[model samples]
Target: MPVLTLNADNRKELAAAIADERWVVACLCAAWCGTCGSYRATFEELASRHPDKLFVWIDIEDHADVVGDLDVENFPTLLIQHENLVAFFGTTLPDAGVAHRLITAQTELSAAQLAAQADSSEERRDWQHDCNLRTLLGA
Candidate 1:
Protein backbone atom coordinates (compact mmCIF):
# COMPACT_ATOMS: atom_id res chain seq x y z
CA MET A 1 0.00 0.00 0.00
CA PRO A 2 1.12 3.56 -0.67
CA VAL A 3 1.70 5.91 2.23
CA LEU A 4 -1.46 7.82 3.22
CA THR A 5 -0.89 11.46 3.99
CA LEU A 6 -3.24 12.58 6.75
CA ASN A 7 -5.61 15.32 5.67
CA ALA A 8 -9.16 16.49 6.22
CA ASP A 9 -10.61 14.36 3.46
CA ASN A 10 -8.94 11.09 4.50
CA ARG A 11 -8.86 11.51 8.25
CA LYS A 12 -11.68 9.03 8.63
CA GLU A 13 -9.78 6.36 6.72
CA LEU A 14 -6.91 6.57 9.17
CA ALA A 15 -9.32 6.68 12.08
CA ALA A 16 -11.04 3.58 10.80
CA ALA A 17 -7.78 1.74 10.39
CA ILE A 18 -6.91 2.38 14.02
CA ALA A 19 -10.40 1.51 15.19
CA ASP A 20 -10.24 -1.73 13.23
CA GLU A 21 -7.01 -2.73 14.99
CA ARG A 22 -4.71 -2.79 12.03
CA TRP A 23 -1.01 -2.31 12.51
CA VAL A 24 -0.47 1.31 11.54
CA VAL A 25 3.06 2.53 10.85
CA ALA A 26 2.89 6.30 10.86
CA CYS A 27 5.62 8.84 10.27
CA LEU A 28 5.05 12.15 11.97
CA CYS A 29 6.95 14.88 10.20
CA ALA A 30 6.79 18.56 9.41
CA ALA A 31 6.58 20.12 5.94
CA TRP A 32 9.54 22.41 6.46
CA CYS A 33 11.97 19.64 7.43
CA GLY A 34 14.44 18.95 4.68
CA THR A 35 15.14 15.45 6.03
CA CYS A 36 11.45 14.63 5.92
CA GLY A 37 11.16 15.79 2.32
CA SER A 38 14.11 13.68 1.26
CA TYR A 39 12.97 10.70 3.31
CA ARG A 40 9.42 10.54 1.93
CA ALA A 41 10.40 8.28 -0.93
CA THR A 42 12.19 5.91 1.42
CA PHE A 43 9.16 5.79 3.67
CA GLU A 44 6.98 5.03 0.65
CA GLU A 45 9.21 2.18 -0.34
CA LEU A 46 8.97 0.79 3.16
CA ALA A 47 5.18 0.94 2.85
CA SER A 48 5.30 -1.07 -0.35
CA ARG A 49 7.22 -3.82 1.38
CA HIS A 50 4.67 -4.09 4.18
CA PRO A 51 1.36 -4.17 2.39
CA ASP A 52 -0.37 -5.63 5.42
CA LYS A 53 0.32 -2.57 7.54
CA LEU A 54 -1.27 0.85 7.10
CA PHE A 55 1.34 3.52 6.49
CA VAL A 56 0.47 7.14 7.24
CA TRP A 57 2.41 10.34 6.77
CA ILE A 58 1.27 13.02 9.15
CA ASP A 59 2.45 16.57 8.53
CA ILE A 60 2.33 17.89 12.09
CA GLU A 61 2.10 21.59 11.31
CA ASP A 62 -0.83 20.95 8.97
CA HIS A 63 -2.74 18.70 11.36
CA ALA A 64 -2.19 20.31 14.71
CA ASP A 65 -5.72 19.55 15.82
CA VAL A 66 -5.28 15.81 15.26
CA VAL A 67 -1.78 15.80 16.73
CA GLY A 68 -2.62 17.90 19.77
CA ASP A 69 -0.45 17.72 22.90
CA LEU A 70 1.97 15.28 21.28
CA ASP A 71 5.29 17.09 21.13
CA VAL A 72 7.31 15.61 18.30
CA GLU A 73 10.87 16.46 19.25
CA ASN A 74 12.37 15.73 15.88
CA PHE A 75 11.57 15.08 12.26
CA PRO A 76 10.61 11.59 11.05
CA THR A 77 9.29 10.36 14.34
CA LEU A 78 7.76 6.92 13.85
CA LEU A 79 4.64 5.71 15.62
CA ILE A 80 3.84 2.02 15.30
CA GLN A 81 0.63 0.60 16.72
CA HIS A 82 -1.39 -2.58 16.69
CA GLU A 83 -4.82 -2.85 18.21
CA ASN A 84 -4.91 -0.28 21.06
CA LEU A 85 -1.29 -0.75 21.99
CA VAL A 86 1.46 1.55 20.82
CA ALA A 87 4.27 -0.87 20.03
CA PHE A 88 6.89 1.78 19.44
CA PHE A 89 7.08 5.57 19.28
CA GLY A 90 10.31 7.45 18.81
CA THR A 91 12.62 9.24 16.40
CA THR A 92 14.41 6.93 13.97
CA LEU A 93 17.29 7.25 11.60
CA PRO A 94 16.32 8.04 8.02
CA ASP A 95 17.87 4.82 6.81
CA ALA A 96 15.25 2.51 5.37
CA GLY A 97 17.22 -0.55 6.48
CA VAL A 98 17.06 0.55 10.10
CA ALA A 99 13.34 1.18 9.80
CA HIS A 100 12.84 -2.19 8.15
CA ARG A 101 14.65 -3.88 11.02
CA LEU A 102 12.69 -2.00 13.64
CA ILE A 103 9.35 -2.75 11.98
CA THR A 104 10.29 -6.40 11.59
CA ALA A 105 11.21 -6.67 15.26
CA GLN A 106 8.09 -4.97 16.53
CA THR A 107 5.64 -6.73 14.20
CA GLU A 108 7.14 -10.06 15.16
CA LEU A 109 6.02 -9.66 18.77
CA SER A 110 2.77 -11.37 19.74
CA ALA A 111 -0.05 -9.32 21.21
CA ALA A 112 0.73 -10.44 24.74
CA GLN A 113 4.39 -9.62 24.27
CA LEU A 114 3.53 -6.22 22.89
CA ALA A 115 1.25 -5.43 25.78
CA ALA A 116 3.84 -6.55 28.29
CA GLN A 117 6.50 -4.47 26.58
CA ALA A 118 4.21 -1.45 26.49
CA ASP A 119 4.05 -1.61 30.26
CA SER A 120 7.69 -2.56 30.67
CA SER A 121 8.97 1.01 30.86
CA GLU A 122 7.72 4.38 32.03
CA GLU A 123 8.21 5.90 28.60
CA ARG A 124 6.45 3.03 26.87
CA ARG A 125 3.60 3.00 29.35
CA ASP A 126 3.25 6.73 28.81
CA TRP A 127 3.11 6.04 25.09
CA GLN A 128 0.05 3.90 25.59
CA HIS A 129 -1.87 6.96 26.79
CA ASP A 130 0.04 9.83 25.27
CA CYS A 131 1.19 8.68 21.85
CA ASN A 132 -1.65 6.58 20.57
CA LEU A 133 -2.64 7.92 17.17
CA ARG A 134 -6.17 6.63 17.67
CA THR A 135 -6.58 8.60 20.88
CA LEU A 136 -4.67 11.61 19.58
CA LEU A 137 -6.70 11.64 16.36
CA GLY A 138 -9.93 11.02 18.29
CA ALA A 139 -10.71 7.89 16.41
Candidate 2:
Protein backbone atom coordinates (compact mmCIF):
# COMPACT_ATOMS: atom_id res chain seq x y z
CA MET A 1 0.00 0.00 0.00
CA PRO A 2 1.06 3.59 -0.50
CA VAL A 3 2.28 5.71 2.39
CA LEU A 4 -0.57 7.37 4.28
CA THR A 5 0.00 11.07 4.82
CA LEU A 6 -1.94 11.99 7.96
CA ASN A 7 -3.68 15.28 7.47
CA ALA A 8 -7.14 16.62 8.19
CA ASP A 9 -8.54 15.04 5.04
CA ASN A 10 -7.34 11.45 5.63
CA ARG A 11 -6.77 11.13 9.34
CA LYS A 12 -9.91 9.08 9.87
CA GLU A 13 -8.96 6.48 7.25
CA LEU A 14 -5.46 6.15 8.63
CA ALA A 15 -6.86 5.55 12.10
CA ALA A 16 -9.30 2.95 10.84
CA ALA A 17 -6.70 1.12 8.72
CA ILE A 18 -4.38 0.82 11.68
CA ALA A 19 -6.93 -1.34 13.48
CA ASP A 20 -5.93 -4.49 11.56
CA GLU A 21 -2.20 -3.89 11.32
CA ARG A 22 0.27 -6.00 13.22
CA TRP A 23 2.59 -3.05 13.46
CA VAL A 24 2.68 0.65 12.58
CA VAL A 25 5.65 2.65 11.33
CA ALA A 26 5.25 6.39 11.66
CA CYS A 27 7.85 8.74 10.22
CA LEU A 28 7.79 11.86 12.28
CA CYS A 29 9.09 14.80 10.28
CA ALA A 30 8.49 18.41 9.39
CA ALA A 31 7.52 19.79 5.98
CA TRP A 32 10.22 22.47 5.89
CA CYS A 33 13.18 20.15 6.58
CA GLY A 34 15.14 19.47 3.40
CA THR A 35 16.23 16.12 4.80
CA CYS A 36 12.60 15.20 5.49
CA GLY A 37 11.69 16.18 1.92
CA SER A 38 14.35 13.88 0.57
CA TYR A 39 13.42 11.06 2.93
CA ARG A 40 9.79 11.12 1.80
CA ALA A 41 10.37 8.96 -1.28
CA THR A 42 12.37 6.41 0.65
CA PHE A 43 9.61 6.19 3.23
CA GLU A 44 7.08 5.61 0.47
CA GLU A 45 9.22 2.87 -1.04
CA LEU A 46 9.37 1.13 2.33
CA ALA A 47 5.62 1.39 2.64
CA SER A 48 5.18 -0.26 -0.76
CA ARG A 49 7.38 -3.14 0.29
CA HIS A 50 5.58 -3.61 3.61
CA PRO A 51 1.95 -3.41 2.61
CA ASP A 52 0.67 -5.21 5.72
CA LYS A 53 2.14 -2.61 8.02
CA LEU A 54 0.67 0.86 8.29
CA PHE A 55 3.11 3.61 7.39
CA VAL A 56 2.09 7.10 8.41
CA TRP A 57 3.84 10.26 7.29
CA ILE A 58 3.27 12.67 10.10
CA ASP A 59 4.39 16.26 9.62
CA ILE A 60 5.01 17.12 13.25
CA GLU A 61 4.47 20.79 12.63
CA ASP A 62 1.12 20.09 11.01
CA HIS A 63 -0.06 17.45 13.49
CA ALA A 64 1.16 18.78 16.79
CA ASP A 65 -2.06 17.89 18.55
CA VAL A 66 -1.77 14.30 17.42
CA VAL A 67 1.81 14.13 18.68
CA GLY A 68 1.11 15.81 22.02
CA ASP A 69 3.88 15.60 24.65
CA LEU A 70 6.19 13.65 22.38
CA ASP A 71 9.48 15.37 21.76
CA VAL A 72 10.83 14.58 18.34
CA GLU A 73 14.29 16.09 18.25
CA ASN A 74 15.41 15.09 14.78
CA PHE A 75 14.09 14.50 11.32
CA PRO A 76 12.91 11.03 10.22
CA THR A 77 12.32 9.78 13.71
CA LEU A 78 10.43 6.49 13.67
CA LEU A 79 7.80 5.24 16.08
CA ILE A 80 7.27 1.50 15.72
CA GLN A 81 4.34 0.02 17.57
CA HIS A 82 2.66 -3.34 17.93
CA GLU A 83 -0.79 -2.80 19.38
CA ASN A 84 -0.38 -0.46 22.34
CA LEU A 85 3.20 -1.45 23.01
CA VAL A 86 5.88 0.73 21.47
CA ALA A 87 8.52 -1.73 20.33
CA PHE A 88 10.94 0.93 19.15
CA PHE A 89 10.97 4.71 19.06
CA GLY A 90 13.94 6.78 17.99
CA THR A 91 15.73 8.53 15.14
CA THR A 92 17.19 6.56 12.31
CA LEU A 93 19.19 7.14 9.14
CA PRO A 94 17.10 8.10 6.13
CA ASP A 95 17.67 4.80 4.35
CA ALA A 96 14.94 2.41 3.32
CA GLY A 97 17.25 -0.59 3.44
CA VAL A 98 18.05 0.08 7.07
CA ALA A 99 14.40 0.58 7.94
CA HIS A 100 13.43 -2.56 6.05
CA ARG A 101 15.78 -4.65 8.12
CA LEU A 102 14.67 -3.05 11.35
CA ILE A 103 11.04 -3.63 10.52
CA THR A 104 11.66 -7.25 9.65
CA ALA A 105 13.52 -7.80 12.88
CA GLN A 106 10.82 -6.14 14.92
CA THR A 107 8.02 -8.06 13.21
CA GLU A 108 9.67 -11.40 13.95
CA LEU A 109 9.36 -11.03 17.69
CA SER A 110 6.65 -13.17 19.28
CA ALA A 111 3.87 -11.41 21.16
CA ALA A 112 5.24 -12.72 24.44
CA GLN A 113 8.73 -11.53 23.61
CA LEU A 114 7.47 -8.11 22.63
CA ALA A 115 5.57 -7.76 25.88
CA ALA A 116 8.65 -8.71 27.85
CA GLN A 117 10.79 -6.15 26.08
CA ALA A 118 8.23 -3.46 26.73
CA ASP A 119 8.73 -3.86 30.47
CA SER A 120 12.26 -5.28 30.65
CA SER A 121 13.67 -1.97 31.77
CA GLU A 122 12.51 1.29 33.26
CA GLU A 123 12.91 3.12 29.96
CA ARG A 124 11.07 0.38 28.12
CA ARG A 125 8.28 0.40 30.68
CA ASP A 126 7.98 4.11 30.16
CA TRP A 127 7.68 3.53 26.43
CA GLN A 128 4.69 1.25 27.03
CA HIS A 129 2.99 3.93 29.11
CA ASP A 130 4.07 6.97 27.11
CA CYS A 131 4.78 6.24 23.46
CA ASN A 132 1.68 4.34 22.42
CA LEU A 133 0.04 5.96 19.36
CA ARG A 134 -3.39 4.82 20.56
CA THR A 135 -2.92 6.81 23.73
CA LEU A 136 -1.09 9.69 22.11
CA LEU A 137 -3.61 10.27 19.35
CA GLY A 138 -6.71 8.55 20.74
CA ALA A 139 -6.83 6.33 17.68
Clash numbers, per candidate? 0, 0
**lDDT value, residue 36 of candidate 1:** 99
Say which candidate scores most in TM-score.
Answer: 1
lDDT for each residue of candidate 1 in 1-139, tens digit (9 for 90 to 100): 7898999898887787778756899999999999999999999999999999999999988999987678689878999999789999989999999999999999999989998999999999999999888888778
- The best candidate by lDDT is 1
User: Tens-digit lDDT track for model 2 on 19-95?
Assistant: 66568999999999999999999999998999888888999889988886677888889989988889988889999
Q: Give the runs in model 1 whose Cα sits over 4 Å from its true position.
A: none
Clashing pairs in 1: none
Q: Candidate 1: deviation at residue 101, Å?
A: 0.3
